[model samples]
Target: MRPRILIVDDEPQIHRFLAPALTAAGYDPLRADDGASGLKGIAVWSPDAVVLDLGLPDMDGKAVLEQARAFYDGPIIILSARDREIEKIDSLDRGANDYVEKPFGVGELLARLRVALRQRQRFPGGETVIRAGGVEIDLERRLVRRDGEIVKVSPREYDLLSRLAQGHGKVLTHKELLVSVWGPAHVHDTQYLRVFIGQLRQKLETDPAHPKLILTEAGVGYRFYSP
Candidate 1:
């Protein structure tokens, strides 16, 4: 599965830029607009990495970072407007994996995130590979192959497929899949799932009209074939 990155900035522009970039780079993007929600996202979601901003409406970003470090061992990259040397030093000392000043380039941010994930060894040991129907998912490598050839999938498609594939045989509820891929804000947006799931079937299923790899559990949700 691709890494899930939680972006804890209140700015809509930041989310717009980062979320797409993160997804295009094969990472799931989740958002929390303020410090409290940010903390909650980190605690509840357990994102693979974080891009946090220092100026939060509810509380200081430093507080969120500190509180997060208390239990969340994953990488946190501070993405704030505060570019002061002291701020960087303090944040790093307080368990931030790295710091990026605001108005930063999307490319640089992605590179930093990549480095943080590498350093943390997000995928530690054995290869995480999943096979269902004709599709082969390599979680650690972030590649989906069909008939021994890589299949290009959108970031959202990858995220949804990854979640379902990770769960293997278990049926994931609509709320669960919606929340994980589109964040809590879109928990009730079941229509989004329907469209994406159909798209996934088209790409992964030899016959989208009658899917075998990704199956629906009637009014419930979806499941990835176990064998």
Candidate 2:
């Protein structure tokens, strides 16, 4: 069966443009103009994937994303005008699989959708083993290796690395990382996250000063750019 793609956007033109593109790509396109309708459609149609917009007339798109995540396990790609790094991080950390800013090319949007779907199929219930460049992380076994050599890391370091790796190219905010690794009380501890990120880069990057894998998004957070 053709994959069903639900597009939740407030703009009518988006539907007009995406419906044909999804059809041409051999997928069934479904539309919802607001968060309420989007949530309803998700419940009724049970689409294979979702293309969501952050701005909805009835509610914020992030709320829709959170609601969808409550019961839906399928991939969700956010299409929004919010280009701020923090917004992108918030959406990803909240459960969005991908984010595409507005004024985006149709080709890029389609490509991102394809990638999210492919990743979903490739790693179903989350990736247990992530291989990027020469680094291999077996989450289940709690093992880390680089260049065919086992790499030793503290329990906290491993926790930090796992959180970054799980983001899958999504930027993670400092608060999000701190909360995930050091618990809720550490959410405001930016220094702690920075120190650990520095350590992670030193271990994972070929050059810690000019990192290629673990990247700092300047005032935002970090993204694990997997190969």
Candidate 3:
């Protein structure tokens, strides 16, 4: 099946540009001009990935992102005109998997989309589950449990934790985690990592202050070493 990609932007030109590009890249393109309709499309079509624009006529894109995170676990790439550092960080922190500024190259967008899809395909036929220490992560089911108790996490938090877990003790650099979880444009946004890492430690670590599960590499990123 051709992967379905939904483009949620108010600009007609964006649709015109992306629909064809996505089709050329072997994806079924879906479109929505406003946040409400975009959320509806997510529920109805259940696209493999989403390209969201922050500037919506009816609502801010962040609101839509929050609602989508409630149910949708697929990759969501924010396509926004706002190029401010805080805006990108806010979106990534709010559960967006990636962010692209306006006037982005189609090639870059396609590459990012492919990365997202590739990450999704890592768990094939229920073969991708990670168990470390007292934590069990069911990738296919998107469930995380520690010591037989369910550990709830936001979408971004889950993504971050999964990335680290997948590394399997291999140190993932700051740039690597930022780009993989927050997109290439945010490779320099280390603060986003700090905030999310703190959140993850609070939830996953027995003691957030002296973390043991997610070991920090000081200048580098982090490693998930529960054993």
Candidate 4:
């Protein structure tokens, strides 16, 4: 079956331009013009992913994210006019899987969606073992080890760490990790990521505060430092 996507934006033109492109890209697109409407659509459509806008008429994007988390498990990519570093950080902190500023190329958006969804599929199913920085993630086994010693992790925590390790040192945006590990519904729950990252660092890093393995990218994302 073709993947379904929800596009939640207040602007009609945003939908007009991207919906057709999404169709061409081999996905179904559902449109919502405002936050309240978007939530309603999400409840009814149950899309595989969502392209969300931060600035909505009746509600801010953060609240919508909160609501979505309460009910849904899917990927959410923020498409918004807000481009400031602080805004991006806040959005990531709030639980978006990825963020794209307005006037973005449709192709780029599609590629990001591909990455998010692919990673999501890797979570519920099995994945190959990943080794980096003395940590071995046996994804298929759902086990993590440091220097051959088994490392304890909850199911969600294992999924989160495995995704980062699987990224192979590439930076993973907050939303990408959130959605991939927690699903589209949990994409906006950034605190969950932060808290669990801290827990993982405590177990994996020689020094949590001065981490040499799980590196932060300030306004962008996190990377599993390899080599």
Candidate 5:
């Protein structure tokens, strides 16, 4: 069954942008314009996950979050323009599962929702064999395959590929990748990371010159496209 996701934001623009994206991602999206109706929706419908905004016409978003947490245990990802550390800390402390600053990418939000749902439900499989982008990554077996045929990759290359795949759809920083695969000492080794990334694309992508699976985030890092 498709998970019913409740979007509690007063902004018409946000609703217009997210509703279709949520549908495309296989979620039945519903909405509420104000805090009163949002709380009512939560009590009546009991959605699987919530995309909540910090601003509301009736009450502060923290109030809604606090009240909702008292009864609803589902994931609540706070979406707001407020980026202050204290505000984020407060929302999280009030039982928000995650906080996304406004003007965010839909893909990032979807990926975060996927992670939150998995953590809450403990969805089985794929942990052992992570599959995405027309390939299978058997983590337990430490193997990569496409079209049922094994693809040979160096240990370092495989490690990098698996790291990116595990983080599917999220942009990972160069420092993060360097530290995860090559250890903390190699955090500054950006060139080394780039070399391994190119190698992985060569082996996995249909066209290494124009990779779709592993995408470069320019100055940031890379994001592995799941589908």
Candidate 6:
């Protein structure tokens, strides 16, 4: 079956430009110009992945993401104009998997979407355990342990940490983390990411204020610092 892709943005030009690209890349396109309508479309269409813009009318794109996560478990690619470092981190923290800045290349967006789809397909049979930095994540069992000690983490927080650790010190931009974790609808909610990262620090870091594991990339996104 051809993958279904939803594009949620307020700009008509976005649909015009991306719809054709998505179609050419073997995806059925569903377009929404606002967050509320986008959420409804997501529930009804249940696309395989989403391309969401952070700046939307009615609600911030992040709220749409929070609502979507209540049911959907697909990839979300954030398409936003926000260029600040913190803004990108915020989106990733909220559970987005990947993000793209505005005026982005269609090729890059499509390529990342393909990557997200591929990753999701690989996890279909409930074999979910990730190990890195002395941390072990049994996603199917909802358990994380370091050096034989179990660590408690919220669902979203664990997802974030897992993705970062999986990257293994590779720099993931805010958009990339957001789309991968949160489902594309929240590629711009930096505040949400900030709060959760803080919580994660408290639980995992020896000093939450001076973290060493979940390392920041200055102006990009967060990464796992393997020692």
How many clashes show up in model 5? 0
Steric clash pairs (candidate 1)? 1-139
Q: Output the number of the TM-score-best candidate.
A: 2
| Deviation (Å) of 68 in candidate 3 | 0.6
TM-score, candidate number 3: 0.61
C-alpha TM-score for every candidate:
0.54, 0.84, 0.61, 0.65, 0.56, 0.63
Q: lDDT tens string, model 2, 84-147?
A: 9889888877987777889888899888777667655666665689878999889999999999
Cα deviation of 41, candidate 6, in Å: 1.0
Q: What Cα-based lDDT does every candidate model obtain?
A: 0.83, 0.86, 0.86, 0.83, 0.84, 0.80
Encode model 4's per-residue lDDT on 1-227: one tens digit a residue: 99999999989889899989999999998889899989998999899999999999999998898799788867788888888877776776566677788879988999888877876665544448776668888877888899999998999888888778766544677778887988899877888888999999999998899998888877577977555
- RMSD list, candidates in order: 17.4, 2.6, 10.7, 7.9, 7.0, 8.8
* Candidate 1 segments exceeding 4 Å error: 122-227
Off by over 4 Å in 3: 124-163, 166-227
Per-residue error for 97 in candidate 2, Å, reads 2.8
Consecutive 10-residue window with the lowest summed lDDT within model 4: 118-127
Alpha carbon deviation, residue 120, candidate 6 (Å)? 0.4
For model 1, residues 1-227, the per-residue Cα lDDT tens digits are 98899999989999998888889999999999999999999989999989999999999999999999889988788898987766775676576766788778999998877766764463343548876556889898888999889999999999999988765344467777888899999988999999999998888888899988898866657767644
lDDT of 6 by residue, 171-194 (tens): 576677777788789988766667
Better of 1 and 6 by lDDT: 1
